[model samples]
Target: MALPDRYTGDDFYCDVAIPSAAQLDVVHDDELVLAYHHTRPFWATHLVVVPKRHIDSFTSVTECDEADVRQLFAVVQRLAREVTEREGAAAVLTNLGRYQDSKHLHVHVHSGPQRDHT
Candidate 1:
């Protein structure tokens, strides 16, 4: 789960217009993608990779989403390399449907032993 919803009940990605780009601690930003530090991190090292355009979840990804999805993964690949090189290992993951707290499609790049986030 993320912070108490500070905005209207909308999928985070779709509301990009609400958060000025300057407010986002963006790592990678382009026409199709955005990668940044997770606002709520579960692991010692965590980063979030998401598309600037809304894509719901992996289940909602379609052939039309191919280019954007590939762009998303490209960001993930670069960040994962940086994380693993720095920490010795890394984990890249994403959730779907009930498993995904936010409806927007995103990937988590993390490192370190798991801990009780709560």
Candidate 2:
């Protein structure tokens, strides 16, 4: 999956990805957030759960309201549980600072073997 140069360099989630999520394989969609399969998955069962609005990263979550944060986690929790049950195990994660590719508060719910990115 060849990503656009802008996707690698900028907040593609806020600028394009999230808005165009309809094209992705969505798992959950609500007023609070959107959960979908990763376009370029690093894990076999990778899914991304993100707040409907941007918040930069996990460390910058204070910018969002408590309810927004709660809702996002609630969704993440459910997805994690589902993945764990179906796949025998699951991992939930969020990156920060330089590790965060997308400048948006998002959680990843994934299971199974990790995939080779290169």
Candidate 3:
């Protein structure tokens, strides 16, 4: 049988509480959101955009969550633009169910060809 896409149920993003400014390859950060390099990247250039406060997933969002939703998208927008300008291309991705390994809300901003990552 094939392995599952997301192995752990752990809230990987929330577990870190954000690494030190030095340890975190942070692309962008604010009170509501964070954009940082993937700890284990599958693309040549991969960044993870997350809400500082947990939101679960896109499907978990609610009317009360409007501000957080906007903030997360704003961060995604800035990072995608910055990466695309530098790399000439970018893609943004998110997943649900088994596709979302971490169980926390996040967006991926990436560019360049895929790479084998640990």
Worst 10 residues of 1 by lDDT: 1-10
* lDDT score at residue 54, model 3, on the 0-100 scale: 82
Model 3 C-alpha lDDT versus the unseen true structure: 0.83
Q: How many pairs collide in each candidate, listed in order?
A: 0, 0, 0
Query: lDDT (0-100) at residue 23 of candidate 3?
Result: 63
Residue 105 Cα positional deviation in candidate 2, in Å, after optimal superposition: 0.8
Model 3: residue 22 alpha-carbon error in angstroms: 5.1
Write down the TM-score for model 2: 0.89
User: Candidate 3 residues 48-117, lDDT tens each?
Assistant: 9988788889899999888878999988998899999999999999999989888889999999999975
Ranking by TM-score: 2, 3, 1
> lDDT value for candidate 2?
0.83
lDDT of each: 0.81, 0.83, 0.83
- Model 2: how far is 63 from its true place, Å? 7.0
Worst 10 residues of 3 by lDDT: 1-10
